[model samples]
Target: MSDSRGAAMSDGRTATKGLAFHRLSAPSVLALARGEGGGAAVEELLTAERSRRLLLVRALADSLGEGDPPHPAGTAPMAHRAAWTLLARTQQRAPRVFENILMSPQTGMWLSLALRRLRGATAYEDAPLWVVAGHLSALAAAVGARAGLDFSLTVPVRHGRVPLPTLGCAVFADAAEPWGTAQVDAREGRLRITAGRETVTAGPEWSRSAPGWHAVRRLELEPTGPGKVLLLDELDPYRTFPHPSPPRLLSADEARTWQELLTGAWEILRRDEPQSTEAMRVGLMSLAPTPARERYRPHSVTAGDAFGGVMASRPDDVAQLAATLVHEFQHTKLGGLIHLGPLSEPSAPPGAPEQLFYAPWRDDPRPLGGLLQGIYAFAGVARFWSVHRHAADAAYAPMAHFEFALWRAQVSSTVDLVHRHDRLTALGRRLLGTLRERCEEWMAEPVPPAELALAQEVAADHRARWRAHHLRPPAAAVQDAVEAWRRGDARPPAALAAPPELAPVADTRYLDTAAVLARYRLGAPAADPSDIEGVTAADLLLARGDLSGAREAFVTQLAGKETASDAWAGLGRALAGATEHRDASRLLRHHPERARAVQSALEHATGRGADPVELATWLGLGPGETDLD
Candidate 1:
């Protein structure tokens, strides 16, 4: 990592953005963003970022000329013309030069494109582009750079539509691998590109597609029949030079499975989400199978770009495949939109709380922005199941219904939280409004009462477990509360202190819904529901409200020793429900979310003393019941 304090750091490599992978010292970036400590710091940035900083200077000065643009994200990356057209919205609250140039859409776009400039980036955090952009934008304000003007950065930085036109041509690379040297030509409409000994070709029509958006600036693909595919997974050198994990070429069986999965995804989108189908084809170019795991599982992930993609294993069914494909694509859409506009508070305004809140879906607490992103993606998942439910079997349809109801509600609450923020740009508000409307529309769709209950229970359980794992009460307040309880005070304090700081759950266990679905489809009994680490396992126990059992499950992890974080949360819940209120209160104080979840479970959970077996049955866990703690 560069010191970022004195000199602009360089590794002899350059990115697309004029600035190299440079990180302005943390204090420097933070100070600039807050518009703190005058000219000296600004001068340093000007020295480091130099001419490259000018791009941001033009982009921001143009889009936000003294006014906040209406459609910050939608405005595209321009300063001069964009500023003129966006004049209506920027009239008030328009940022003057050197203001808190925080979360500007054009600024974000410039930064993202610039960040992409880093080739085979080994250590990305060393010089984060976002912070660099913030510093540069600040420098522009300090130097007073304006739109349509020539500018330069002394620092050196070096630096795709769906269904690309198909052509027939043989490709060759001068080097051993077709990375920097690869070339493609389609003289008569066939396409080929050589990588190592392999050459991927399209005979006049590169019609194959790998299945997968939003106001996502829809990209219309040339009607080349179907989806597009990227033959080469290892875009950079293959010897693990750049990315964290290299791509694994699929085995023949895996390839066939993938092709089938793609076909299934295409059908689903063609029927309900045509926009998504196009986005998948036009945006995503590469598909690489996830590395082998000890257990059979399906996984899908994508970096913010529309290009690279990953899948873990062949799913027992295509529906499972479709859900993850759509989920990550929504993230891609959101990433793109964020570049175009700010969806939530991008950074803390000194004196404003930088508090992280519990998200039901994650083991760790997330910033509001992170929470918003997950909810939006899951809400999209809900929409997916809305259609998929009808296509599912009797045993599986209920699960689909539950998924829709649960995520829609979750997204609605998240959107509501985001909506209340006064700092949201007009475009951000519009996007959230649309999302809210969509969530509300789908949430009202009918589902079987029993299944809806199941969905609510799972959602509620996860939230409780998350709270237990994360939320904490203030230490001083907790001490006072402990004292009061010791004195046998019947009254709960008016307002308690902030939650205690606890370590966050690093990587939580993922739910094996696909496994559950497979068992259901085969008319086979579900094996015992293992206590999963993270949100899902805790969810299974907490859903039943077996307070003591949950505590035991956590403290002992009967199945296996799990994370201490989970144990503390489980113990907190069990203790809270018992007469020994001190331990419970302390635990709850440490895990405010856990406390809240428990309270909610008690309020909504039906049938007290429900056998563990019956409770598990109700929760679709097993035919056999197991008690809570």
Candidate 2:
């Protein structure tokens, strides 16, 4: 290895000179906005993110003096200085290796967390200054090993493991103390770590059989396939966002399943979505496996700090895995673009709070930024399914159609909402406009009429359920409606003209039964009528196209003593599908809160429930029919 002192002599300013002013070309930005960019655009974003990480590391190093007290061993300053020296030498000797480690997702994640703590944005609870600064030494070790430079440094051991950022971790036998320091020595691309008297050596292969070393397993489609390689990260603590999460390594069988699924998904992507495949190869790097979520519904998240990292649960099938990879990479791309510039204003105008808008993908209200993210992500998802449907097997084709149609409508509508938003910057508008153009094109694509209607019904059902759960009618409107009902007036009140306010109800359970039933019906179209979790018989009937049966069942449920919010929404769907009850259907679908309020008032006054359909009809009546107003 080069002498540390000699490497540190290079001027840092010269090395990082123009990184702060990095910009993406207008064409590149437009390409990314439409979610059709090739690898070149993603590479630019990745390069910009790399620059951001470099500047961030420099900033953290410079801020060490202003924050908490120095580590008792002065480890923070020492590691900081060593990291810079190693980075400089690597850049000179092996620029590619240097870029890899610097642009590593964990590197960015650690930099963000460490900087946040240094700036006092978050409290440093159990993590001390030395432990936080130890990541630098970790980075140094990875660079030295990859660059084949002989170097020795002391790195922190959290929970008896030494993480080398992009490479892998050196696991140690259990010890009483949760936190300790280990000495790492790298020579000729081989590595050794020593804690106390125990020492473990790893050769160039980073042999998993080494006494206490766990290599980060790599997943690829084939031994020499064109698919990009991804590290299945289970040992790195900063593999996730916000804080260091304890490693949850997958079992041997679970890991094998992941490999198989990745291979299948990679084949699908390579064959169907070539452009997405190119983007993934450039921007998607590692996968951190999370615990399994609901069946047929995988959960995934990406961090703005961790540009190429994806934290996701095990998927149900190859199709799901492929979709997840595409969905999350979209977030990764958008997150990189956001780092280059602001899309929306940072804050709402002076006094007023930021208005939250409806994000069809989420259970809660989302700010404009969150809504925009949802739009971009699902736009990519919609595009994926739009192509995937034709390529899917006959059994899965219906599901593909449903997903493509559903997300197409959802993303399109949300784009329109955000396009009209007041806080969007000029760039934001352009991005959205491009997105709108793409969605319009998708709208012109032909989907099976049955799938289209089902998709639209599901979208409306979600909106109505969201409205019932999160919006409340004006108090005056509710009171006037109740008064009119008691007076036997045929006309509805004028206060109903006023819009509802956002008053979120805490209990959101069963609000997505329509979506759940849609999935169940599409996934198991011939299954028995057994009760599905979080779904009712009425929900099932409604999802299976039995409108009259569903309406009868929903009416029975509403006539019972305990009725859920889903029943009201389901009844709305049933009426909308039927030939009768047009006005009642509109009232329940569009203003469910109104019917809900009036129903509750009547139930409280009479000590029993009224016919939901009859109540909806009364509430839906036009004004001045009987001069009630």
Candidate 3:
């Protein structure tokens, strides 16, 4: 085995010292093996026995902030000190009891505690942290093992709070490995063995973090039988690379779209630029984890271009995925050139919040203008796909609508690019004009066979517009035309290359619903229930005290959803306040949405004014008993 005796000291701390993962002293190890401290310690720590655990936790947090490893588990090379720094702060907020469990038993009993806490706690801090740590530890341990460092390591302290998990600082050598690796049994979970890699996962059984605003808990590894094992876990080369597989909770269709987009991107890479894929992937892998958040579906991202592996809350169909793949892949390849120098500058655009958005190009010498170019380039790519010929018809309008929305909202940023690259921007305008013209011409004579052709034209124009926007001396006419079009100009010449078919772009019902669900996960305000085309949002309103509007909206939204349990529950709640006993009783009679709601309503009614027998009969509750919280 390759010795990583000093690999864990990347930022100064040694493995055998105060760090989390060092080898235990002979006495402690013996105590652990003899059961004097192992099981009892595990139970005690997992259950939060005393204040000492909190101090150890605070120390662990401090250590993590200092970038110290939990034990001997992590030996992977850290490319930067940021992970260590961030881990330090993250640990300080983590539950100390959970930290002890990992340090003591090195098992995943902390996960059970986390799950219990998650079920009861309302705050992100109250959620378990070890589960998250355990997962990361699995990743690190896996990486270390692949490096030929077969050191026994303790389980991680899991975390995924509003605060996030703490990471340790450890460096591992021997990163390369074989496709099918070896395996080992560890305290936290099974270690999938590979040449230079170790994968420790508890399947979805330990995925206890609450769904928060802008993030979802997706199950990547399938669950096994009752004992908790992950299944069908193939190691992707991408996974081993430093590039993160950002947390993506995709529906089956979105997953398929992602696959297709990657497939198409691969084709593009292989055909047009053989080295592009390797370069792009390598660059991505080398990206610091913090910047990587902006690159994809990051757990802590606030805002940036939705590029790389980042999935948006919007519905991503096959076409949208295809477009995004092409767009982002181009950006990834182009990122090297655009983010580098000559156009770089120190200033952000007037309205833009991030400096990265306004820099001219990666190569710009000035700081401000450089980064702005990168943003423009990516936005341009997304815009191009918005009008692709295949994407023109109403069948995909939601995608177009979203693209257009982003484009329109971002035009102010274009002015910044226009000041820098006028000529390129002008050509883009000319192309956009042609695209709009074609869309108009096609619309005058709509036909199904020409659908793909129209989409292609739209895509070409989309590309042209942004490319022009970035060019020196951007075409003034195109900008004017774009502005005019935004004002509801009917002239297709400003937005399309030809006459276009006047058809609905997409059926947004399912996508909207999915987006709504996504919003719920991310902790964002959902669309007004009444505004949602197909779903009932009325009960949601009544629950929030908007009684008058909720009643009206409910009447419209819940018309056909009377059978929905949630709908019925809302109606029951709403009806309970009505002065008319008959109306209230009638709504309450909707067969026990869940046996419990019926019984609860009966008790609540008895406390209010209704006689117990009458309310019980109305609720269909048996006369013998009642339950209430």
Candidate 4:
């Protein structure tokens, strides 16, 4: 935790040589692979991340070489050098306070972004140079305030707001400029900021009424016996991933709601998953709330460089909130581990054809790295639901059980595919093997028959939908099938049996309709399906276990001008449920893209539609079969 631990040598080598050669014990690695790292392991990760951030900060400074500035007054090089000098002085006087500012999640994010911008790896349109380098000045201001130091520095003001990295933001009401700099003078724990002719001042304690300063809110929760604090950060420009954004501060009511939801979620995790609770208490530092998206489907993300930070939309309930924490923390842990060593070979060469694979949780195909992350994340999710199901009430239990059943299978199958990949290194193979063992252990656990069936149906439906959305059959094969049907041939051409290749489509909407409907059914069995946004009547019938009704509904829809991929996948689900029309069901489920392509080609050629089931039956039958019946 000392400043020297992360100090860079003259040649830019990290002084902390142990970090370069760090290795986790076998037991610790196994626990992490199973999504159960204790506090000690997390502490190691946090320390490593802190060192990485320090290295990045040094690199950022180096990138701005010590050369004469084109605009010597108030340029990035000048500001960066001034900030560095102030930080070194502050570290000498108040080491702990300096460390706190250095380790702030916003500091890490800013370091990565500023370095990228300096190195020309990213573009920032019309952004003033001070906007990137001024972060160091903001960090210095925060440290000075905390350490009761006397200092004055000019920091960037973006969109009329001056944000002190970890402390809070100062708003300028009279300032109309889009980008400028504010001079902050701090002495004896008091802060005064002046921009142009306007000025604002605040005492040691922040206050909304203290002229124009907004305090960074912190949430304190006692989930277990000990208290834990997390910053409800909405004012940090670096809170978002990849780049800086304008602050989206929460309202009073919204902030209170977030506090309540986080409290309940922490309590649930404390009661059910104490090990995970410990890991989070040590490593999960801040939560940045994004605008809410689709209901019951909260989006969450963790950046590789921003360790201990999570950016998530509001959740539907406490259980979901807790699960989101678990899911994102898994990503946080894996990101740290990958930074320590190689997991897979350097990413596939650009335009590599075999790079992308099926990811059960996403709408589009994922590359190998994304697939690995998803596998680890959903494995944690499956583990969460596996235990949460036992604690859930009757109304919620089905959904919990279904989630566990579905993800266990998905993670296991994905692990099987990744294990055989040629790119995994020795350490990567070891980690994957440990993860596979945990998945195998979970796979043996029994679920209720009905919930298990629903889980299987949802999985199959997603795969079929993904296929229909992303894969395209060979054009020659499709044309041959169309021609044979036009000639009134008894069977499809043998060429139609060729496997499909990926020609991804752009329409990804409604791909998760089946899963969404399943969740709704499990939560409120009698809920009206027509009220749902993406759920169709046929989907409702299938969700309710009315196979015959769903089959007829889908058939009627297909008989018309409807060419939606969901209809084809829906018919496949209904037929699979009925256990009749096996040939047609198999074709629709496995080669949905092929079947749809041939059907579209035939319709385009003759200016007339054909029977959906009959077309599938014909294509699915062996080449030797002579009769459509």
Candidate 5:
């Protein structure tokens, strides 16, 4: 066991030696990243180069203050072997540089000279590069000593709210039960670490204490022997730390609803594997600990998983809670399959948001901005698909069919984009295609004859209810889009052709921003091909006192899709008292024809001898339409 002063001297020597190794590793990595020379580049070059530098640094640090040239005994032998393997691999890959620089002692001398030159300068040449090198050297020393890998593991420890990478000397030390520790003191604007048992206490950094939980910064870890300890350290002022705030405690009835939600979802998971499912449930219960825990907070689920794992946050309210759990749980499953490696790697591309794969059950209206809302819609589609696969037959009740259709249509449109689709490899693409085929089968296949009749009856009831419900303009747009599809006109399916005229300002200004409200027709819950919104040519025709022209516009709009319900309604009204009354009657009877307001307006206009002024009054037409002159 070395004393603190002796250890510091040895650490200094190790740092000097490691820096020499780093200099040699740096230029090659720089050259490679810059593409200075070789055309025979492999994709793994960066990783390989990094591994090589780390290995060589480990070697020099390990070799220092050692017995023999070859180094002796235990983990050192393993470290030597690993370094040798890396050297051999590097030589084989880039022999010219390996021979000229890495294999020669002269290269070390050259690097040392370069370091002396930099040391004399007023300004640092490359801060992060040097910092990473110094920190990594210290880190490797500590980690090597602790892990017995002869390599560093540097974890940033907080000091008075500032974190600094502390150099661990064990990364270079050769002894039984090697250990390393580094102290960081931000209040003094410096770091101090003492080896062995030495009491060094610093002041507090940050604190967060609630009723049942406490989070204190300045976590400290004292090395017992080899492994590291978990201790509080100083917290940062500039860095924002989000603490979980407690929610209102659930009442008995609310708790019961949560329980039912959890139970129902668990039944599905239990069907797959009961033991594992129960284990997860137990784990989740442990994380929350009590009913007042905030569920939506970050790391709440992760923290819970550490204990046992909870299936849902509290599990209150069967429909809402189960929907939420199923959505997130689907992510856990499909994310693994798609991520194809570690959970750290995202299932989708770099820019993709988490919500893209995990839609929430609480159906809050989207964030105010329509573009932001649109972005969420994109993610919602993927989330819905993941949740949909686990949904029960009866689960399709209460807008379930609509939800499924929304997800389906999004997948179709998104897969058509080359960038998004190209991210899918051939096999992934094939798998997605197969999934689509399966979905189509489910949607188109007739239920058994008994169920078929029952489904038709249900569909009829649903239609009547839907019609009886006040059709908000967006809802009418969705219905019109659906009817347009039935009539064989579906284009741009739920896409805005151009950014709307007042898109930027109006989108954010009004509570009921026309663009965002209209966006719902083209998004999740009503992603039908015909669900177009935003003012169109039909509005123009109806304004011009040209019912004949408006009817033509309605026919054109419905020719490809039933996107505009307002347009459809206008057309119906225009023809109601005309020579084309028969044609108008047929259109008025069409599914999702006109709103009650529009229908009333049509009756009034017909009774008033097709007067434009009277029709405009009934239709809630603006001053622009009435030609007030």
Candidate 6:
């Protein structure tokens, strides 16, 4: 390696531009934060991220010397074939601060998983293999090396923290084993790692011993079913990290409840989807309780690709557990697929936040990849429920059936848009084909006519809202049309294009039970003032032909101190329904949702729809409807 480095230096082919990595003084960084408490934390995070990235730079320089990616092997063994694929194609450039290693989205997740799997599979038993989790330590290290920040496996865990992997986190470790153990004493806020002949502990400057090492208590996984099942409580992420809000530890009775849920869900998966069960057994190994605030969500998340551990809030709905498992495991699976090959090529630009499609599952507009993930996840969920729904009780069965039909149609339509996309590689195309097959099979499954109608309405309402938000006619054209209509001119303008609308200000898109069965099953979990569920409910009310109820709900939701965008959009539809089709351009022309409502209301007002003059008076758009005559 030294000879190679010397040779590269001689030939001027070395990656070492030898730029010194600058470290920002803590005091200086804090001073820049202006004494604002949260700002200080932000500064600290930035410092840590920068410092860790510098370490990666050092590591990369040491590893590669000068050769291109897929260069000669080093100290530790790696799943080099798949792991190095991205490296070979990676564009080389001078290492700069604040720049992330070139990776597709979630590539970090896969690298961590690959390391974990590699560590588990290797037979060397001399020393315990360390699983490096946190993205800062693992991903940055992997990608940095790819970019020529060449160093060996072991990395610095910033702030004197142990590189303990997060639950269900993807992790990394050196191919070569460290000479000694790193003893961590969280109770005393101390870390001692002895790699080779070097031994170091945290100094005073290092705070809290490690990045997230807060717990003095060891979270033991108590084996239930005499080692077949595990009941875990202490593994909560809050316990590990300095959390703003830590969840209260579950009592023995609470653990019992969790155990029951896990056992039941496992049974369902083990029977219905054996592959999912096996994948989960291999990937998802530990469970951590989440804070209450996370309830009504998907109920679970893995830190990265390290599937051996997961954190989730206890669920009110047991059926949701299996569904969550399937959903998250798909992410893990996708991560592996990513490591294996590029699903999406390097060409067409990734979708920006505004251009993303609004998925039914999330309040925010998701990038195309995110939408693809959503549809793929749902496909798995649909498959699970397709077989399992029949065995469920009355309320659960209908909800499951609704879920199956919804995802079936949603995935089908979504695939059509993505199928011919230039970004998809051959492997990506093949995956989509399989998903389409599953969708077809599930779409054929029987759903009650009424349930199906309800599902369709929810689907249509969201799509229409998305369309109204994103897909718009040109503003000039719309203005021309409006003016022409005002002038009693017949011809309409050509087109209006609008940017896609994401949900307003952090809406909690709770994973609620199917709206069709919510009344009989899960009750309304309160959402913040900005959530779109109210608007969704209002739409459902309209679909039921309960015009007054829909009006009242929309108005009530809109009555918030600030009118949410969704509420305004629903109000437009509600006003149109209530007035029997008129004008809702009364207020909110500044926003697109409201403008569309106005247009929709006005468009339907004429031709046996409603008395335009009366609607104008009722809606307060004007003394009377636009005088188009």
The most accurate candidate by TM-score is 4
Give TM-scores for every candidate, taking all chains together and pairing residue i with residue i: 0.54, 0.90, 0.30, 0.92, 0.29, 0.56
lDDT string for model 2 (222-314, tens) is: 566755788888878888765678677789999999999888998899888888888888888888998887665578988999988998899
Candidate 4 pairs with clashing backbones: none
TM-score of model 6 vs. true structure: 0.56
Q: What is the lDDT of residue 476 in candidate 1?
A: 49
Counted clashes in each candidate structure:
47, 0, 126, 0, 30, 26
RMSD of each: 16.9, 5.0, 24.6, 3.8, 20.1, 16.5
The C-alpha local distance difference test score for the whole of candidate 3 amounts to 0.31
Give the alpha-carbon lDDT of every model. 0.43, 0.79, 0.31, 0.80, 0.30, 0.44
Per-residue lDDT over 1-629 for candidate 6, one digit per residue giving the tens place of the 0 to 100 score = 01111111021233456533233344432321211112232333333333333343334433433322221134222322223332333323433311333221122233433243333544212222222222233333334333433332333232222332221111114315323223222123333344434444432223222332332222322234323333253422222211212224466677667777777777777677765665555444455565444334445665423323455677756677887777665654454334334455654454533345557766456766677667666667766777777877875677777666676677777876676666677656766766666566667777888668667755654554454454444545555545545665433333322332344434433223234333232233243322334436765575456767876776665544443444544454455533444444232222334245335434544322123223223333332224311
Model 4, span 1-629: residue lDDT tens: 23345322123344456533345666667787676797888887777677777778767667766442233264555566667778888888998888777877778888887777666666543456557767777887777777888887877888889888667888988888788788889887898999988888876885343668888888897845689999888988888776667778899899999999999999989887788899999988899998777666688988887888899999888999999999999999888888776678865685567578988899888878888899889888998998999998887888899989988998988899888688887767877888899899999999999889888888889889898888888899889889888898988889877778887776476678888888877875666656666678898898888988998998887777867777888887788744458878877877778778888888888887688888877777845333322
Query: Which 10 consecutive positions of candidate 1 have the poorest summed lDDT?
Result: 156-165
Instruction: Estimate the lDDT of model 5.
Output: 0.30
TM-score of 5: 0.29
Better of 4 and 6 by TM-score: 4
Clashes of 4: 0
lDDT of 1: 0.43
lDDT of 5 by residue, 585-609 (tens): 3333232322333333333444322
Candidate 1's error at 471, in angstroms? 2.2
